[model samples]
Target: MIGNKAVYAGWKAAGMPDMLNGDDHFAYIVGYSDKTVHPQNGITRVAVATIFFRLLTDKVRDANSTLTNNYSDISRGIWYDHAVSTLSKMGIVKGDSHGRFGPNAPITCAEAMTLIDRVLNRLPESRDDLLNGMIQWSDNTDTSKWYYLVVQEAANSHYDDIKSDHHEKWTKLRDTRDWTQVEK
Candidate 1:
């Protein structure tokens, strides 16, 4: 319930419908229920919800800006309008060649990675050293698999272990875990 309302409020605070995306998908304003499911032509609540949360993340403020919106699409809900515009402006997403962001489309790994890369750069100069490399630009060493190079550089700088990526050690990427309390 809170998530749904937060999404709605976020969109309203920005603008309304954004014409950048032609998607006139349904808005999950009414909080999700057990029976709720995406029909043939509907957007998932997860994507919408995550975008809402991202607005409140530390990265947004670090960008030296606040989320703003302007309604370009009249058919979509105010929620979609605001979310799309804000996302596009943030450079996290973009419209196709025809100048229309496909709001209903599922975001891909490349897009998520690009967004996170941008956020990493916006961290404060006083942020933990572990995150410093990301803030300070570095010379491109390895061209192929730039992402892999980044992960390796992070390890070399003592921020994380190299095993995180090479070992497919996804567990290490978690924000929280009861490693001390987990039953073996």
Candidate 2:
């Protein structure tokens, strides 16, 4: 977002609290929890895996990435570290310059769009496979709202069960032109 107000409106339209302003953007993802989940130090391994599994669908045939093993070694730092291993294994996320994914850092809207795009790209593609995926989870130069494009793609692809919370943002964004800020 170019300005704080636009970013604030976009997040608010994306079903976030009005109080979450820029630099405070990440509060939308973690602030909802009564307690803060530290990406490297505060989060649990199992907690991250569970979130990844929820994004899986019928045709996502990645057995190795299923993460059904003893993840005891990874309870190291931050909540997103767990997400990195599985998501990276699934070819969805990557880390830092030294190969470290800052799981605790606040992600910008553009980066979030690209991340969702990467995950969607990994899914198996087949004709009429409704359960395969949906929304425009790509970083199209023309996609007015990259976030909504991903959400809509998930919906269109029939990605089994995204929490209704994210979907509700789509409705509000469609109803209001609040997402334009991200475009600017």
lDDT of 2 at 146: 34
Q: Pick by lDDT: which candidate is best? A: 2
lDDT of 2 by residue, 43-92 (tens): 33334433544445423434534332223334445444444555667655
After aligning candidate 1 to the native by TM-score, how far in Å is the CA of 85 from where it should be?
A: 1.1
Question: How far is 120's C-alpha from truth in model 1 (Å)?
Answer: 3.1
Local error of candidate 2 at residue 32 (angstroms):
6.4
Q: What is the TM-score of candidate 1? A: 0.35
Candidate 1, clashing residue pairs? 16-81, 17-81, 18-73, 18-81, 19-72, 19-73, 20-101
| Cα distance off (Å), candidate 2, residue 47 | 10
- Identify the runs in model 2 with alpha carbons over 4 angstroms from their true place: 2-53, 58-62, 66-82, 122-184
CA lDDT for candidate 1: 0.38
Error of 2 at 158 (Å): 21
TM-scores of all predicted structures: 0.35, 0.35
Question: How many steric overlaps does candidate 1 have?
Answer: 7
lDDT (Cα, tens digit) per residue for candidate 1, span 1-184? 1132111111122433232222334343454477654444334333653444344334442443334433233134444554555555665445555654555566543344444433333111112213323423343334354344333323232223324222211112223333345433
